[model samples]
Target: MHELGIMTGVMESVETAARDAGATRVLEVRLTVGEMTEAIPDALEFAFEALSEQNELFDGAKLLITMVKPHSCCLACGAEFDHDRFHMFCPQCDSFALELLAGRELHIDSIEVDLPDD
Candidate 1:
């Protein structure tokens, strides 16, 4: 599964961000995953739980995922339609030059952290 690699990237990014922010511990990480990404949330969680070992920032952190649906707009006909992972073609006019309006995104929405005492 590519989830492991995705998780590693996420962890590394958040870890660096947390450290830079002077956070002693990371409490939670929120992510917005696109529907077209076809990522298994449970499997990703499992990988995250397994991979985050002895990481002071992520040892007991929580992972939250929000799924987004794929949307597309036809460049030829200027029609908008819902895009599916299995089919990348435009539904309205069967155009191959459809522009993706949504989905296929994997990024961090936000993070919760415990700041050190001042």
Candidate 2:
């Protein structure tokens, strides 16, 4: 699944950041994912677990995901509403002209790491 590739990239970035910050270990990773990306939560978690186990920095690290619903704005009626992936049409005017306001994001929000003590 594409989730593997996605997690691979995420792990690379996280590892680099943690090392650069002198982090001894990663505590948690918070990710914001949107429904439009179609990335399954379970798959992502599985991928994270598999990848994290390979790295010492990620031992016992927690992966927290925040799911974002699809939200769009109607270009015709200037109305905003939430919708599913299949239905993107504006509910107020029934127009197909819509601009997506959210639900297409796949990014790391924050990372909690244990830094070296002085």
Candidate 3:
């Protein structure tokens, strides 16, 4: 799945940042994934496990994912609500005019690394 590709990119970035910070090992990675992105959590976890095994820096690293529900604001009634990807209409006014306030986000919130003792 595309999770592999996604994890590959994430690992590359984490590696670079960890190295730049003089980290001896990566301890954890925290990610925020939106439901609208359609990225499967199980698949993402599997990908992370597979990729991490290939890198020494990621050994025993933990992957923490925060799932974000799709949130939107209605342009018609100024109503804000949470909804699934399929139903995007505003509940208050039943209007299709909506602006997404959150979700569709794929971001690395933070990384925990073991830095060299200097």
**Which number leads on lDDT?**
2
Q: What is the C-alpha RMSD of each candidate to the true structure, in Å?
A: 1.6, 0.8, 1.0
Global lDDT scores for all candidate models: 0.87, 0.96, 0.94
Tell me how many clashing residue pairs each candidate has.
Answer: 0, 0, 0
Error of 1 at 52 (Å): 2.1
Please give the ranking of all candidate structures by lDDT, highest first, separated by commas.
Answer: 2, 3, 1
TM-score ranking from best candidate downward: 2, 3, 1
Q: What's the true lDDT of residue 50 in model 1?
A: 85
Worst 10 residues of 1 by lDDT: 83-92
lDDT of 3 by residue, 1-118 (tens): 9889988999999999999999999999999999998999999999999998999999999999999999999999999999998999999999999999899999999999998888
What is the lDDT, from 0 to 100, of the residue 66 in candidate 2?
97
Best by TM-score: 2
What TM-score would every model get versus the actual structure? 0.88, 0.96, 0.95
**Ten contiguous residues minimizing lDDT sum, candidate 2:** 84-93
Clashes of 3: 0
Q: Per-residue lDDT tens digits of candidate 2, residues 38-107?
A: 9999999999999988999999999999999999999999999999999988889999999999999999
